[model samples]
Target chain A: MSSWRKLAVAAIAAACIPAALGFAADKGPLRLGTTPTAAQVEGWAIAVRPDGQGLPAGSGSVKDGDELYANVCASCHGTFGEGVGRYPRIAGEGKLTGDRPEQTVQTYWPYATTLFDYINRAMPFPSPHVLPPDQVYAVTAYVLNLNSLVDDDFVADRNTLPKVKMPNREGFNWIDPRPDTHDAACMSNCRPAADVKVSQTAEGKTLTPRTTGPLDTAMPQ
Target chain B: MAEQPKEQLRTAPSSDRRRLLRTGMGAGVAAFAVAASGRARADDPSPPADPDWSQSLGPGIGDRVYGNPSHFEKDVIRRNVPWLTANAESSISFTPLQYQQGIITPSSVFFERYHAGRPTVDPAQHRLMVHGMVDRPLLFTMDDIKRFPSESRIHFIECPANGGMEWRAPQLNSLQYTHGMIGCAEWTGVKLSTIFAQTGLKPGAKWVLAEGADGAHMARSIPLDKMLDDVLLVYAQNGEALRPEQGYPVRLVVPGWQGNVNIKWIRRLQIGDEPWYTREETSKYTELMADGKARGFTWPIYAKSVITFPCPEMPAKGPGIYEIRGLAWSGLGKVKQVDVSLDGGINWTTARLHGPILPKALTKFTMEWRWDGSPALLQSRAMDETGFVQPTLTELRAVRGTNAIYNNNSIQTWQVKPDGSVFNVQLA
Candidate 1:
């Protein structure tokens, strides 16, 4: 073959090799094809933010909420939301800090809208959505009243629901100390020689040390 | 001795000799002799032997169309907390993994965690509504869903918080309680993409909110990219209508995602431009890290494997040769390999994986070990197709901190004592 022709063929082969490899890499992992349209994806969006971004438009009164709560929620949630067994108690509980603290709506929940959104979406035990929008509003009002967050006559419609501030609203904070550090306290200082007297095991039986000699070899003379 | 008796018999009458010999024997021998003589007196007699119970019962019928687990498994049933939540209206139950063998948790024995108890929905009346960011909003009936081309894949559905009890301390005694919240089944359903194709997708659609028909109206927002990737509107599990506990008429089978996102008793699919901050996506499934920052939208369950046998409850019968068996799974992809460590994490031996190692399915793995009855900590680690290795407890804690109660797929260790007692232990 001619030298020029050979050179051309080799150059062409080199170019084709990379293109073939790129195609194979692009094929990548076996994946399911895309089918869901962008519009169909939007209908199910229902997240509510602490800043009230996704709060729906609705309202209810604390008095009506109390009546709805008695009929639907009191059975399992206890008369005053003390909770029974696995069901969480939602009222009259303080911050879940200190010893023997209770985690309830009054103590733990950061946003009042969370209760409204949760109850509206999944509440009242059996036959969900059996209650209309107004009843859900009333139930939220009643739950808030039970928690002592709102007055008995306060209305809890969507507009008023977001306005009701929870006691533990400032309880949760975004405190991410990136790159954590742990240091041994013994590294810096040691007790005085007279104060560092070793004690023998009880009954004059000494425990076998897991390691030989002193734990730290470096010491100030 | 026999010759002297014969000579005496000859000296006396034959009948008298015989009586004398019988009297010389003990009373018991004489009674046996009498019985023998009586039997001899009869015309014919048969030898005695044990009776056959099967012959009396007769041969059993053969060949059944559908089979149940052995009659011995009558005690194995899905048990629920009677008053843990609500009565039948809303409740949760657990699968009896202690009584189960092999990796596949029977559909009947599969655990159920329902916000509202199981809902009884007629298949005919069941409708799946798909609306939102789409060119056309379409509602599909059960029959309409069946008309589409269906794909059957063996996948595992696991609750993200399966090991929630062990987040702070080793609270559960058995692996069944700590890791029983998972089950594998051959799911047959139409791909969510196929349905998505029917309604042309809009440009900005990024998420899909799935809702259930149960009393809780359980809902979760799934990323649109994930739905387009590998999601199924599963109608059948293990070749039958999903067990009532799973999802009777239909359920969204999100492969490798948390069990909660696989919405059971599904009735709606709303597509949107952004995540619908549903209670499930924000308040419930969110993980509050030790750093105080909540980790939200953490969907994919990482690679996790556990040694089921020789666990805390079921210890090794004795030292000798034994089979160390367990299950390994990855929600992100297929489980590539599982390595078993006998001496904490010092030395790892590859376990023999069995069955089809399908993507997002529970792959059963086993290994043979000769226990010397010495104190040892055993654990298993899994690697997935994406090159992600199962992290150790310390490694996981280093990243996510100690406060989160979700996605804890760290290697679990079981400490075995000389007296055949196994206890849950953490590797230092």
Candidate 2:
């Protein structure tokens, strides 16, 4: 093919392909997926909202929850929700201030619905979303009772779960008022020279992973 | 994260284990030398004779259908802190930032953060559902989603807890551990706007709850405004199919937002009238304040910068004129300027920003400095286009306190000793 003819041919090919491809999209969105059936949607509709939306038809007592929690979650969360290993503890002193405030279910979690949502959607470690809604509700109620947010006989259903008011429900500030710090790009005398003292160092802490020399023999601290 | 603050740190191994570790390392080195027997022997003439490589033809292309970094670069792997999580399956790993050169983090060493374990999802069976408050609820197969208009964008996905460990002090001793919970990569996918329009969002659809198909069913509620602006349903990253660690077949890329919001192995995007307040958002990602009140929906990653070359892992080799390199970024906008401080924050010099300076992407910065063999505190501070400067640790603590274990973008300082060794440090 001649160079001029090849250029003309290439232009036509390039122009035609996108125009054809974009025909549906230009009109609107390139609606590619199928409109799912009610059954299909139900299979994946697992989210439970703060207002009690998306809750399934089931209930569980704190008694049942305690038994279920022992069988399924005790290995990591501990017997009394005190936490095991590096796993987060479920119980706390209901305190939110200190050198290191423990933000457990008792102290920080604001919504009880979130407890049910998380347990139903993801729980039981290595294997999650395996529990039925009844079991999930039971576990959620048990955890609520542990946090002193519910009575021992209290049950968590689609109706009751959202009504369980948490102690720290009003403790959160919703908006992020960032640009919170006002450190400008000052070139000189940003701070006094003496103020640049090293407050502390990680040298003697032995926390750093070693790279070479005899220090390399040491394992991670 | 599961244990108390102090208990979360790894205790040193017993001295007997250290002796065993030394013995194990010696054997590894000896094995490596034996494996490299085909290379030119030490006795086989230095410059007088050509090396074995020049004498023999190299392996053909078919030897490795998929290419990898050189064997010498084996040390450049993502490493996880032992005490960071309950198990390796649901933990975080740090990218070796000291070894990284440019803004784009290689997929092999990209930082990893997972709520549950990494799921081996097969694309053939994977389904992406868009339901809830929409005109036309739909289910998309992988191929179906890819057929729409697609674009590739380079943006950095950062875990808000990137520097959470050092909220109070400089505990983590390396740049990788301190700031490696982020990775900037080229994400190629269809825009959420394109898909949402197809789904035809109904009125009052204010939030889109994205959920992953991983074992944890990880989910987060993102506002509609941000979703319409830059959210993408990404399947390809860095010019290839997404790495399994980075949500293989498909994922959601909420550029500039907290990394947890970028749902990996994404399966569902439920358009809703209100936020679901999933476990990640309510219990995990929220930042606490000094007055006992916590802050929820803290999304944007503020301006931040760190000097990589003089970090603990990459120490100053001798004291000569050197190009100090670092990375600066802002979740809100472009990194406008980066200031390098040799003697801590007392004196500062502007660094030359290079590479693609795209908004919400990692920007590389370089500055020339001469180290006169004297001990110095090295620091870098970034200012974004929004006029928000990276704050000092003192400034952040005065407001947010040490307990807010997320969004610690304070100025990182490295104490360079006179002997050319570097250590992580905090300014008084």
Candidate 3:
């Protein structure tokens, strides 16, 4: 039998024992999940959106963020938010137009709330989800200051966050305009041989090691 | 380039080729087949020999509680492009697609993407909290979750940036590097809707913030409609407990969506009215368009297919009625049909779909091919049940431009030379 079938049989057997022992068997939708207190919710539920809905009641200044960023984020994100080794540059370039566009906070991101949410949840590379709300706010402010979106002393909080307009605020479209190419299921003579051109070629990098051998090699001769 | 391969190809009928696959022959046997085909071909073996029976059966059964792949399959592993990330913790790895067979990808080498690296979580201590807009905020232990109605379904989790590296140019060399950010497996778990029904979602609960228990606390705002659709709070992958690299105790499996949104080490699910606009959704997964504008919430992976054989890694071994195999899939729905092109996009022929072609799962396809030892641009075009055919590289670039890194599910091409060598190439 399949493993899932075995698991289902085992689960049924486990559930029956409770009723057989004359214990109060759980009812209604398996009766799983314990009602958690407000304190329990406070331990992990932290997420901020574009509308500043989840922004905590805390204030932070870009000036304070600059010092904190240097002490914590500079090693990986670079002192100027220029980025070090592919760690994502928070500033410098803006609004990708060139062939190789640098997708930084100042240029690409449509919302400032994303900055606050990311830093609080996943940041600093080595350690994450440890930053207090104020530090996250300060860093968000500092990143915005670097992007020239806000002044250095600008304090960001729940109310002030939604009001801060991003440069690419209106730079996003909704509908997925796909099935763009109208290449029919042409069976034969679709394109001329001369028309076909080799546009790009592989870098020839040996990314994956080749597997070609017996399981066991050496033996005690 | 070699006389032996051409002569062997002329001698062997197609039935012998099918027998080779059915026997589950080792690489040496396959190598001998290739060697008999040609000396210039890959795996140029010296000669076949009888097994040294005295050396065999050294280790007894039950020696290892958890078994691993054959020692020869050491190279069949997840690999990384070192230059992609600053540290290994926040890096991603590619699945060995060319080495894989059928639909299910082995749990061990299923591509890994870690935000704060794989967390070592004790299942006993792990807890799943469902709060926010729910009528009753609930916390469920591992044991409590298993009691819910369980489901087992085969689905594929694909990273949106599967072919993102080759957006501008064909950079990677192998099939694994190009289309390895995907894995299909039978995931067994409780449906999120089943769990949410008990929580009783409040009136305007449109979205839910799925959070992870890892150090990164990785989070993504998923639509309730999607959560109710097919999303799973998975604890087991394939037939065993989930690999630590793929969220051990619990993880959210957002079927048909980008892999990132399927948060690993999932801890909390906060039902809310609006999207959280997390960094993952905004800065990372968003697609940058041509007009300097960007598009967000672009989730579903479109129709895509790639030639597994004759790929850079596994080139045509002096081609003789070879079973040209590959994988075809679509996040939209089931793959309705797949067409193979031998001469770029000039001519097309239907390839047979193998195994159970389930929705949102990898579908294996094969075609009987007789290579004439000529330079050819080979490609596969996949069309889903939704009638959305996989776009060509040129067509994809024309619409999306080279900037949109994620969701490059275009038809991939493998240029096979007369010498039986294959190179990744883009044709116009």
Candidate 4:
């Protein structure tokens, strides 16, 4: 018999042997785990991409989102999404290139679906992934509305979320234009003496929080 | 060790006895012994009932269920700047770089960054589900994952926000705060390709979504090319099961990449044709460029180095002849060379790099400097095997501005004063 014919016969036998047996054939020496069903896959795969992929069937209006935001998010993220304490500010617009850029869903986020995705996955600060899909859409809509990206009564569903154009949609690219800064390994006399200056000092700054005791207090003095 | 305050020394019981002895014997052997004992008493609060620990019967085996660092090494610890974040649960802590001796960071002092807090996961209950665009979907338990062929490699895991605090200005006043958001470890795990081979990939599968089992379910989409390259499904670090904060049950170790992509408490990996553009990729880790345009998927950490000795926390005593030591690492490959500068960027000298320079791991570098107690600016620059030289703070800010807030691997400068105190400084 030809070599190709023998390989085809072996392939047929390999496929038939699995059907002949009652279980799925092991690919390696260790028959490690069971094959998961589609239902099991859906239960754990919850990430929603920029193209609205993996979104569950749900919808929420901006009015409902405002109410939800007040109850669950207002403490950490302020009533106006100004952000309290170290929580991120979620509502701002048009200062991406400024000295103090107020990066928010409106100003810096490249896609609207990210708001929905982030809210669905991790939100409410104290609790995460507790809100149902509808509330996630509503909260996303409310945050966007605060930045004037959507109407107060705007409804966000899978179809509408992706279609809603974000202000910075065209602002991002995947190209890495790095190795951007270059410093030569010059041994001596690399630059003129007059060009050097100490631009900043952290003299009186209190950066780290004071711990209860010094880290080295337990060590020998 | 810091010097004891004069007030503290005066109040100490041993010092009181020593003062009496010195008064009795004005200037002689008794006075010298009293002074020597005073210094020793200051270091050890307890009076020496016995000579030393070697003579005493220390606790035998199994006295400690798990071993700990010696009592004298209590200063080596993971420290956090509490005000940097909203709360402890969603914050970052730095490695004690000044105290670390070699390339591999001890499991205890490794820096930690978490979106949510570290989860206490039971290994037996943990399961990793692999599905989507595969010939067969598989759900493997932790025990089953260990059955696969395994390999051990030493690599560095660094947060792109390592030197981010210095972007706006020289804000943090210590080397640990400036360059300690990183740690190197000997990771033991099964190669990602081994798992991929078992669950055969379908045609057109190009991306893999790695999702963690933490509260945030932290997720990132890694390209298939990277998965096939050097990524490992790690279960152990530094010869022991991973610590809870380091992703105990299981984690993905993406060698040579930034830390965020190496998701901890990893539970699911879904193969797909396109990237998942997760929230981390879009809102958090993306580098905001100077021209209002943001750059996504800026994954690899560049070459970076910083002088650990004579830093803000470990200033020189008198500065005669001291060996300046530091760590240099590169994601692309092993570090080729490191240059030490005593007078800012005007002059540089090649530092001697220590042995066992593994790829993608921290390489130790040292240089002997003779200081005349003069005020000087000290800096260290690293060059990776790729011939990529580390950049200066001025050079980096010229291109990236102060807003990127991530991937700041610029050379750090420490200003040494005439009094031998070192301060974190930014020179332009």
Candidate 1 residue lDDT tens string, B320-388? 888888899987678888888776666678889997788888888899989989977788988877666
Instruction: Give lDDT tens digits, candidate 3, residues B115-198.
Output: 888999999999999998876789999999888778999999999999998888888788887899999999999988678667
Worst 10 residues of 2 chain B by lDDT: B48-57
Give TM-scores of chain A for all candidates.
0.59, 0.82, 0.77, 0.78
TM-scores vs. true structure, each candidate: 0.72, 0.89, 0.86, 0.87
* Model 2 per-residue lDDT at B45: 52
Regarding TM-score, does 1 or 4 come out ahead? 4
lDDT of 3: 0.79
lDDT of all predictions, in order shown? Answer: 0.68, 0.83, 0.79, 0.81
TM-score for the A chain of candidate 4: 0.78
For candidate 4, lDDT tens digit of each residue in B144-168? 8998878899999999989887888
Q: If you superpose only chain B onto the true chain B, what TM-score does each candidate give?
A: 0.83, 0.89, 0.88, 0.89
DockQ metric, candidate 4: 0.32
Instruction: Give lDDT: candidate 2, residue A143.
Output: 88
Which sections of candidate 1 miss by over 4 Å?
A: A1-58, A78-80, A92-103, A106-113, A145-154, A162-221, B1-66, B75-91, B96-103, B398-402
True-structure RMSD for candidate 2: 12.4
Cα error, residue B96 of model 1, in Å, equals 4.1
Q: Which prediction has more favorable lDDT, 2 or 4?
A: 2
Candidate 2 lDDT over residue span B63-148, tens digit each:
57988897867678787677666677888888888888999999988998877878899999999999999888999999998898
**DockQ per candidate, 2 decimals:** 0.08, 0.32, 0.31, 0.32
Q: Candidate 4 residues A90-147, lDDT tens each?
A: 8865577767777888888888887887777777656898999999989888888998
Q: Highest TM-score: give the candidate number.
A: 2
Structure candidate 3, residue pairs in collision: B5-B37
Worst 10 residues of 3 chain B by lDDT: B48-57
